[model samples]
Target: MVTKLPLAVLLSASMLLSGCTVVDLDENGQPILPKDPAAKASFSSQTPQQIAQENWDSRVLKGAQDRALTWNDMKNKSTALKAETSSSVFVKATGTVTAVSDDAERERLLTVTINGESVPVAIGPVIRSNAIRDAAGFKFEEFTNQVQFARLTKALNQQNVQQLPKIDGSWVGKPVQLTLAVTLQPQRIEDAVAVVIKQEQP
Candidate 1:
């Protein structure tokens, strides 16, 4: 005669046969599974752009206070003050447009003076630095080359010029505010080769 197994034994045997572990359930009956080690590893290895994007709202926006610096302060105190004041290499400066370059190259330059020091802002047809990508939290590595960079910058430049039509000429001598992405090697700050310029409303 065949004998029936106990309900507990039957359940245990079924679980063992299926190689399944008991899943803990929440009060609402949702199964809770262990976090995947691979996913955790992948998250930890996220790219700079990804990390920057994730922290953009908190770190770049709300956490860090805007520090207004003169061009001289930027030239002299960029390294020291940046470390003490903010986590980002980006900064905001207000000044009069003392000069603007007439170069028709993909990269255009604008010079502004604050406290008699000149700061240059580059608007691009060819954006070379990763400054904007880092500052704006873009996935630049996905583009990977000059052609892609050129395409992206061209599109950006077209859109920006529409808003500030005469960025090179009309904006000169006007009091303006700029949010720039700075680079220490050559020691320059620019418009991130995009729409980083704003004319102070009268």
Candidate 2:
């Protein structure tokens, strides 16, 4: 008769014999997977759900602030390119609200004139882009799998829209200051998602 060990026992023994460490400790407790040294650390331990549980309050805000540039500087192509990571960047701009999209639209946006350029800030019931996620400095390469990364990006976008206070006609014609996270494919400024909007200080 042949004897068989439980699946769990076999797996544990395999890991022990392989001498594989689950995480490298310096990383914030995410499990090691799909090791790629050419880029930043990648992990497999944490699921999109686990990371998304905290919502927009996670490190995204600080990351955006720390890596942002003034609107004037970012408007220059070379400067913006240098600031980009994974083809996105964070920009801090002070602008006058030039126009606000109709509330009836499912995808609403606030058009702000930053240095005389009309830039659309999506204050959304529906946000359709990955600008916020890309601008926060996270690259797609850092994720172990595409499905999880896509799910995480979707969760991040939802959290982003949810984090905003209500937008209304009252906000039009107001001067606002914001650190905007944008993608850099043609106009997006960042890949790591971070956005902070505040009334401009006089």
Candidate 3:
């Protein structure tokens, strides 16, 4: 007499022998579904959910593209194309506060040059510390502005790249470079602070 095996046990045995299906992983860790041969000839195959997911993912990384113009990229592109310097500012200076009478009322405008382009930047006349005083410190207004600049730098660095630029058919065989564009406005901060500027007596 032939005995009938339980349906559940038979299904489990088949699955074990066949091995459960594994999805393929793409470069971005996304699961790539197998393309069906039968579906190739068919029309109207895409679903609404798939379209929605694509749109949602595209919007998430838009900001990364805007803030990623690095100096190296500009320099490299500058060689190939005409590039212009837009914003340059002298963020810090340690020279003696000369002519602090009328100009002391507002921030002093100083010319900052980068790549031979001169940029005018205004710096605060507020003195955080006096040379005559034993303790040296930055003035309140200038100190606050410096803090704001630091925060902006931090925020931009943490941003993610959203969408990459489009590549054409001509460059299909060529290798393309992907780089982070971090354009920091030129600001002369405290690279190294000196308490005293020594001069040799002639």
Candidate 4:
């Protein structure tokens, strides 16, 4: 049967179709949010763990494979490398482990020698650098907020550390091959391994 519809109802449906949110207001003219969420309630998250899952394969490992600078190139010719690099870079290093810091596992550091350059690599229970995050080449301005940016940093660090093999004093003299994320104008011995992809030890 043909029936006439209210103009208001038609207009409301049109507004909804146009992506306008249907918010309810209270007496004071403020939004009256829902008490219990509905089935379609949604939230967005890119936590460290989630981030790790998304980027670990295509971005972290693969990207490192494509964009990494040799340890010697990163250390000896950094200025020239920086001039050519317009974004984040990975430093690939392979060397024998010389020492391991006994600090909290999160704060642990492993010393390795690559191309005669001895440096500390942080394999964290707590990573203190933004190596992987920055190496992803994301711009800070594009982040919705500092909190999101921090989440990305945590995510990258988590992704990298998850790939690390177990380590201890026994690992000394074992050959380790890893990738690190470092800035063009690095100050510290460069942040440690973004990931330990190969460990030549039993």
On lDDT, the leading prediction is: 4
lDDT of 2 at 123: 73
> Per-residue error at 188 for model 4, in Å?
6.4
How far off is residue 7 in model 3, in Å?
5.3
The most accurate candidate by TM-score is 2
Better of 1 and 4 by TM-score: 4
Q: Model 1: residues >4 Å from true position, as ranges? A: 1-77, 81-88, 137-166, 185-195
Residue-wise lDDT of candidate 3 within 1-202, one digit each (tens)?
A: 9999999999999989799688889999999987664453211333323322342324222322333334344444334432343221111221211121234344333332333433332222322211111111112232224444333232221221112222223322232222222122233211111111211222
RMSD of each: 9.1, 10.4, 22.2, 10.9
Per-residue error for 201 in candidate 3, Å, reads 18
Quote each prediction's TM-score.
0.47, 0.67, 0.22, 0.66
lDDT of 1 by residue, 77-110 (tens): 4455443243224566677887776757766778
Taken over the whole model, the C-alpha lDDT of each candidate is 0.55, 0.68, 0.30, 0.70
Reference-based TM-score, model 3: 0.22
Superior by TM-score: candidate 3 or candidate 4: 4
The global Cα lDDT (0 to 1) of model 2 is 0.68
Q: What would the per-residue lDDT of candidate 2 be over residues 111-189, giving only the tens digit for each residue?
A: 8878887788877777777776666656667677788777777777777777776777888889988877766643443
TM-score of candidate 4 relative to the true fold? 0.66
